[model samples]
Each structure stands twice: as C-alpha cells, then as structure tokens.
Target: MGVRYLFQIGDQIVYPMHGAGIIESIEDKEIQGKVHQYYVLQLPNKMQVMLPVGKIKNFSIRKVVDTLTLENVLHLFHNGETDRTLNFKERYKSNMEKMKTGKIQEGAEVLRDLMRMNKEKTLNSSEKSMLGNARKFLSSELGLINGITEDQAIDLLNYRIGK
Candidate 1:
C-alpha cells in the first residue's frame, strides 16, 4: 500500500490511550534493516511516540476537532447520557471499549458517566484512574484546539461541566 501521510510536523493529533499530542517530526528510520517514515509525536503526558507512516491507518489516528465540534463535544459534559445499569465489571469493560474508539465525543461521554457515578457513589480505583485519563485526554485535545494550556482546558471543562 502506498503511504499516505495525513499530518505534518506541528499538527495536533490524538494518539488514543495516550491522549493528544503534537507531531514533533516526520523522520525516516531504519528498523530491522528496513527504512520507514515515522511520525514522532510529543504527547501531553510528556511521552513521545514514533508511529510508522504507512501503518498509521491501522490505528484510529485523526485530526483534532474544529471549534464548532469542540463546542458540541464539551456539551456532552452537561447533556450526555449515562449507563448506570451495568455491574461494576461490565461498566469498566464498556467504558474501556468507548475509550478505545479514540473519539473525543465518546471520551467526554465516558467522563460524564463516570462523573455522574462518582456523584452517586465513589468510583472504584480502576474507574477513578480511567476518569482521570479521560479527563486528561479531553482537556489535551481542548487545549490544542483552542490554543490554551492543558490546565486551562481542564479548567474550562470543569467550569462547563460544573465540576
């Protein structure tokens, strides 16, 4: 398959399970005697990842949302639906699947549901971690989209979500 590069250096993108990041560089590296182009991203968690250009399509890599979509995504904080019927294990599995989708909207929904659950009763340790990661992912993307720091985006999310 022909390589199709979707993002350039400095472009903001989401690298699922790792939150959002900026494309730091596009470099050709020799791995196991084969040269391939890789996208090196500077992640929000202070991590860097090198993904192969040709294999990016195998993942759910996508550009960040525009301002209009950002508004709608943040809206989920207030109006998103929650699933409170599942047992603890089932709920955790379900939320993991949603987070894997790498969609900001879905992540927001997960955050919303988890927050609501915490309001009713304290979340378990695993869920608390998931909630923190989800919040980070959402806030990172928001920061990149609106040109604010992740802390500021988090503040905005909290303000909008009434946290």
Candidate 2:
C-alpha cells in the first residue's frame, strides 16, 4: 500500500537546502528489501529530488506561501532594519539557521537582511554565495505562488536591490 501523504501531485512546496518545487508524483520503491514511499519533487531550476514520504517531517518540507502571506513577507524588503550589530560570522550563523527552517518568511528575512548588508558593504565570498542561495529559494517560491508569473517573481526578487 502507498503511504499517506499531506501533499498531492502538483503541490508546490519548499525543501530546505534544495529550494522550492512541485510534487511531481508519489511512488513506492524497495531498498534493502524494505518498501518506502517517496515524493518526486520537480524543482524550479529543472532539478528533481525524490525524498522518502516518511522522512518529510524530519526534513522540514513545507508548502509554498499564499498571496497575502507573500505580500507580508516581501514587505521586509521595503521596511524594517536588519540586525547589523552582529559580526559577520554571527550573522551568517543566524541566517544559516533561518535557511534550515524551509519557511518562506524566514527565507525572505535572510534574503532581505543579506541584500541590505550587501548594499552597505560587499559581503565576503561565503555570504555572497549565501545571498545567492537565498535568492534562489525565495524567487523559486515566489514564482510558484498563485497569480505570480515567473517574470514577476524575478522582478520581486530584484525589487529591493535597486532601492
């Protein structure tokens, strides 16, 4: 029998460290003589990942944001002050923790703060890379949101950068 799943095919979701994607299908597979259910997720960048259905809880997988929620999340870009007092190492650690949550809001905060910091002074190699990954996460989910076209999503990702 197939395992119960909270998400169905075509459901948009975020996979921590992997960015956002659509659930392409559910299938059963046997490994080491044991059967396991897996969710085949198709990422926005055309990459695909198959994760065990039973392991999603441990992995922090979650659904994409809704329109209203997205609006509020994006507001971080235009308003609010970033935590600039923390040293670079401390700030990076905090952002890394936020990224691990796989939550859209947290990802947006990371993106917003990092982008603002980048504006103040160029980030180091590691942070520049982190900023890029945050963009990938936030933009991919933004594009998956209802009424948001891919182009519009890209625009949203770039919105505060120009300010």
Candidate 3:
C-alpha cells in the first residue's frame, strides 16, 4: 500500500464527525520508536482533532466542493427528488457513511434526505441526533466555501428544503 496525502498545511478540510478543520502543520514525530509525519489539524469549533498524514486516505478526509457542484447540491435539496426511506436507523447509517467520506455534496444529499424524512413525522431522539450531525457537517463546509456564516449556511439549507 502507498501513503496518500490529500491536503496540505493551511488548507481547509472537513472531518466526518467534526465540522471544518484547518490543517495546522505537518511535522515528523516519533511514535513508538518510529518517526512519522502527520498533518496537524485544528478544528476551530471542535478544538481537539489531530490526524496523521498517512491516515487521511484511510480516514477518507477530502477537499470541499467547487462552486458548480455545490450549486447542484442546492438544487438537490430544493427539488426534493432524491430517494427517501422511512427507516431511521438505516437512513442514519447511510448518511453517516456519506459524511465519513468527506464529500460535501454527498453530505448535503444526506441532509436533504433526512430533512425530507423529518418533515413527514416527529423524529425520535436518535434520528434527531443524526439530523444534527448532518446539519453541522453541511453548515460548516458550506459556510467556508460560500464565505457565509454558519447560521446563514444552515438557513440556506433550511430555505432550500422549504423547512
């Protein structure tokens, strides 16, 4: 296997469970008698996430969306034409995986799907948590990419979904 480095220092990236995290530094550290280079990431809001250089690929860390694709995400959310399911656990799990891939558009799709589902009924606690996670992921990345506030990004998402 080969080591894969997807981001450089000073680049903004999104973590699966965490929101926006900036690559703070790249340094070589001795861990268990082996020297390893790692990408130090600081989550402005999370404040405590650190990732190794080689782990980026394994962890599925990735860059944000370009303008056109992000616009498509907005369209997907607004149109409400994607697939939906009534099973909360199944949907949540699928969304979690999408978020873990570090793809902004995929995360947006998950959010849109979940939000549509939520509109149909009262969400349970677990489903609510999943919704929150999806919201957090979308808001952070969308805000940074669009140069908007997190609140504004969330509002845009809600507005597009007509919620």
Candidate 4:
C-alpha cells in the first residue's frame, strides 16, 4: 500500500472490464479504522467506480493509448484475420478475456472477429451480446482519443472492417 499515485485528477485511464474513464478525484476514506486512498473514475458509460490506489496495478488500470497506438489498432482492423475454427464457447471465453484486458488493440480485434463471424452466419445470443459490448469498448476509447462521437467512431470501425 506504499505505492505512489500514478494518476492525477482529470487524467484519462482505462479500468479493465470497463471502458475509458477520467479520474475525477483522489480521496482518503476511513474504513475498519484504516485510511485507504481511492481513485474515483467517471466512465464513458456515465457510471463511476472508486478503486483502491494500492490495487490499481493489480486490476490492470492503465492510461488510454496514445495516437500512434490508436493508429496501429485501426490498422489491425484492415488486416486481422478471424479464427473461425474455434467453437462458440471457446471463442466466447477467449474474446471475453481479451476484452477484459482493456487494451484498444484487443478490443478492436474482438470487434473485428465478431463482425466477420456475423457476416458468415448469424451469431447466437451470447455472441450478439459480446459484439455489442466489444463495439462499446472500442468506440468509447476511439471517441475519447480522436475527439469524436461514439456513433462516428462506430462508423469509422465499420468502414475500416469493410475495407
């Protein structure tokens, strides 16, 4: 619990299992007779999460990718191949893990793969849900980094995938 704070108020960060968020505040809260520092993040979904400062690294909390990394992720959409051999359950689990990493590239891959699969055949309920979630994750980050609307980001991704 001696780790120094890595993020400051107003910094943009990604919380694994969630999408892009901004650090709103750093506060000390007393619980069980111990004082703990927490990072309050306001997510793109408008939901807020308070995370313990000591556990941020363990939870994979990280800053949003820079422009170069964003460009690389966009490039991935154009050339990434879908692994269609995996069964539904296997693919779902794998994709879920990737999404949980909260990396822009991984989210883009999941979105691209699911879109390709959807084109080949109708996706089941689970896949359909994952597709929506992946899209949200990708678009949220894209919108934040590129200063565009989420709808615009979704259009950009679809256009890239179609290319």
Using TM-score as the yardstick, the better of models 2 and 4 is 2
Query: How many clashes show up in model 4?
Result: 0
Q: lDDT tens digits, residues 40-134, model 4?
A: 99877679899998888888778988989988877877787889789988999999999888878888888889988888889999899999988
For model 1, the stretches where C-alpha displacement exceeds 4 angstroms are 1-4
lDDT of 2: 0.84
**Best-fitting candidate, scored by lDDT:** 1
> How many clashing pairs in candidate 3?
0
lDDT by residue (42-144, candidate 2, tens digit) is: 9877899998888878999988878789888767556867887899889989999999999888887888888878888989999999998998888888888
Off by over 4 Å in 3: 1-5, 82-86
Ordered by lDDT, highest first, the candidates read 1, 4, 2, 3
Clashing pairs in 3: none
Q: Regarding TM-score, does 1 or 2 come out ahead?
A: 1
Q: What is residue 2's positional error in candidate 1, in angstroms?
A: 12
Q: What is the C-alpha lDDT of each candidate?
A: 0.87, 0.84, 0.76, 0.84
Worst 10 residues of 1 by lDDT: 74-83
Order of candidate numbers by TM-score, starting with the best: 1, 2, 4, 3
Put down candidate 1 lDDT per residue, 31-94, tens digits, no spaces. 8999999999998667889998889988798888898998877765687667778999999998
Top TM-score model: 1
Put down candidate 3 lDDT per residue, 44-97, tens digits, no spaces: 564756687766678777776677877887776677565654365676677778
Worst 10 residues of 4 by lDDT: 154-163
